[model samples]
Structures are given as C-alpha cells and as structure tokens.
Target: MGSHRKPRPSSGPFNGRAVRTVLLAAGAAGVATAVPAHAATGPARAAIVSDSVFSNANRLHHTQTKDSFTVREFGNVRSASVRNQANAASVACSVDDKCRSVALSFQIVTIAGDVHRLKAVNVSDATNKYCDGCQTLAGAYQFVVSTPDPLKLDASARRQLADIERRLDVLTRSTLPATELQTRVDALAGEVNGVLKNAVAKAPKGHDRPDVTLHRRLDGWPGH
Candidate 1:
C-alpha cells in the first residue's frame, strides 16, 4: 500500500503569534484536577503571564497567536485552555528570543458567592538561563483548574497557569484608599473562611483537622 499523504503546510509562517496571545473567561467553571497535598485548598481561578517577549517600556514589535479550546461548559461560561497553538508568532525584529515555552497556575477561594484567590505560576524551557528582555518583568498566571494533574502539565495548561497567576496577583493585592482597603481586606478574610467552611462541610463525618492552609505559594517566581 502507498504511504499516506502528508498534511498540507500552514498558510503563513505557522503564526505562533496567533497562538501565544492571552485569553480570559467571563464566568467559567474548571475541570477537576489534583494538586500537591499542600495545595488542596485555594484552587486558582485566574492566571497571570510573563514572557521574554513582552516589554512595557519599549514598544517592541512582536507577533503572538493563541487558541482557546473549550474543555467543559458551566452555566454560560466554558472552561478553556491556551498555549503555543500556532507557529512563528509576531515580535520586534530587535527582540532577542530566549524562551521556547512557558507555563503558570492559580487558585481561587470563593466567599459568599464571590471569588478570592491565590496562585503558583512559573515558566520553563526558557531560551536563555536569563532573559534580558523580560527580566524584572512579572510572570504570568492562570487558574489551577480542576483538571487531572498528570505527572507533568501539557503546553496549554502550563501557559494558562503562568498567565493567570501573573494576572491574579494584581487582582488580589490591588491597593485602595484606607477605608476601602479595610473593607476589601475584611471581605477577603470572609472569602478565606468560606473556603475553609466548604472544605469542612465535605469532610468525612468523623474527620477532624484542626487547621487548614488556605494557599500554597509556588516558589522561584516573582513576589512569591
């Protein structure tokens, strides 16, 4: 028998820029996934992202591409994933490309139907041990997502996590005036307590754990 025909090449330079772009959800539900033992509480619901290619100071020209694949749908929102879904994305001609890939993760604690969260985000397969362009820049973030935690995360999940965590940190720590700050801080405390209560409610009838750790900070990233 003849060999199967090869697939046709892409229309353009694989256009990774289209794939590398970031995506957000309006109101999404996540796939169930297992975290580290210590990470059981405070599942990330948003992502933060940073890459060697991004620079806010110098308007560098770069190509980016992204694709969001819906994994599951809840209410009107669909849980989706993103990553290097395209090829040879856009970027400044002067920019030095150092990283091959990146990834991040996040967790959210809901209080009174509102969400308060934390995250652990990271990037890997960097082109250089250190990237000059993106150094001192914040990493990305995303939801820890309730998906199955395989031994390693796939590209879509990794980048999603990195991007969401990077963004969520800002949302969590956004400063405000003293009066509003106190109000928000108290609101946050209530959210944490809400998560603890939910966990307790689901515990086995006789299970007794005096203390619960609400969040697990992923190491080696900016601002812990």
Candidate 2:
C-alpha cells in the first residue's frame, strides 16, 4: 500500500485564534448600531404595540367581511311585451329584508311628455378598480328621462336624483386611497354617469341635473 501523506496546513501567518478575534470584533461593530435589546422590548411598549396591531387587524376584517346579499344587476332588460313601450322606471334592491336602504341601478329608454321612460337594471357591488364598494348595501334604483313632451318631472325621478347625488357624495369623500382596482371603478362610474346624463337631458324641456350624494356613515375610523 502507498504511504499516506498529511495535507499541508495553510501557509498564512494568521492563526485561527487571530482570525476569529478579528471576525468577532467586526461582527460586534456591525451589530452595534442596532437598538439595545432591553430598550427594544419593554413590557409596556410591547403591550401597546400588540393592542394597536390587533385593533387595526380587527377593523380591516370587519370592513372586508361582506354581508349576505341576493341582489344582482342586469343589462338589456325588456318590458312585458317586446312592442310595449314602457314609461319612466326605477329599480331598487335591498339586501336587507326591510329594503330600508337598498342598492339600485337605473336606465332611461325613451322620454314621454313629462315622464322619462326608465327602468331599473340590477344591483352589483363586485369588487372593481374604481368603486371598491358598489352594491355593498341594498338600495332603490331610479332614472329620469325627458322627451319633447312638456310634462313635469315625477316624484320617482326626483327621488332617484336625490339618491344618486347622495351616493356620489359618499364616493368622493369617503373613498380610500387609490389602488389598482380603483382605477377601473373610476372609469366605470364615469361611463355610467355620462350615460345617465345623456338620457336624463334628452328632452329639450328638461334640464341636466347634478347627482345627489349621501354622507359617509363610516368615516375616520382608526383603520380602513
């Protein structure tokens, strides 16, 4: 058998002890800037931090958890008969059995004398880019259209106008900071508003009106 040879040790003058000492010193200096362990974890400080964090998380969950709803919005609605021209209409959906405050959608097909032929479409609050909060609640939908007919606006149209205005107010004032989804929502709201405006003012006799918006019921919470 061939005789085994010992591997030559490193030729450097530096020994393990010296190298280890240098490394330890360097490591200590690097960590020196960190906050002291005792200062970083006082009991009072820990309790405060934990409470704040928990409160924020709880608030977020409360906001995100949806209430049950059966409302839906649909396009291309029809009257009883394909030829039966319907008059001004409105549709309001309340998820709550009471329908006290429901989500609503509306469309104006044709204008009559003083009445704008309108219909309620559906309620939808699916998460989107613009209004992250769509039909979060059940509400009535209303629309007003005016034709050449010189009739007075009905109470239903007025009610819808007021509701629309209220919703707009809430959206502008209570909306949170923008997100990727919000961009899409803004675009959709703009499009819907434009359509409603055109339909509402189709009659030379009627005037274009601003939407009424509601005040925010939940604003200024510690967290969203």
Q: Listing every candidate in turn, what is its Cα RMSD in Å to the true structure after a full C-alpha superposition?
A: 17.6, 32.9
lDDT of 2 by residue, 133-155 (tens): 22222111222223333222345
Scored by lDDT, model 2 comes in at 0.23
Which parts of model 1 have CA positions greater than 4 angstroms off?
A: 1-103, 107-128, 133-194, 198-207, 220-224
TM-score of each: 0.23, 0.21
Report the lDDT tens digits of candidate 1 across residue range 191-220.
Answer: 433443454344333222322232221111
The residue ranges of model 2 lying beyond 4 angstroms of the native Cα positions read: 1-178, 206-224
Q: Candidate 1 local accuracy as lDDT?
A: 0.26
lDDT of 1 at 110: 18
Which candidate has the highest TM-score of all? 1
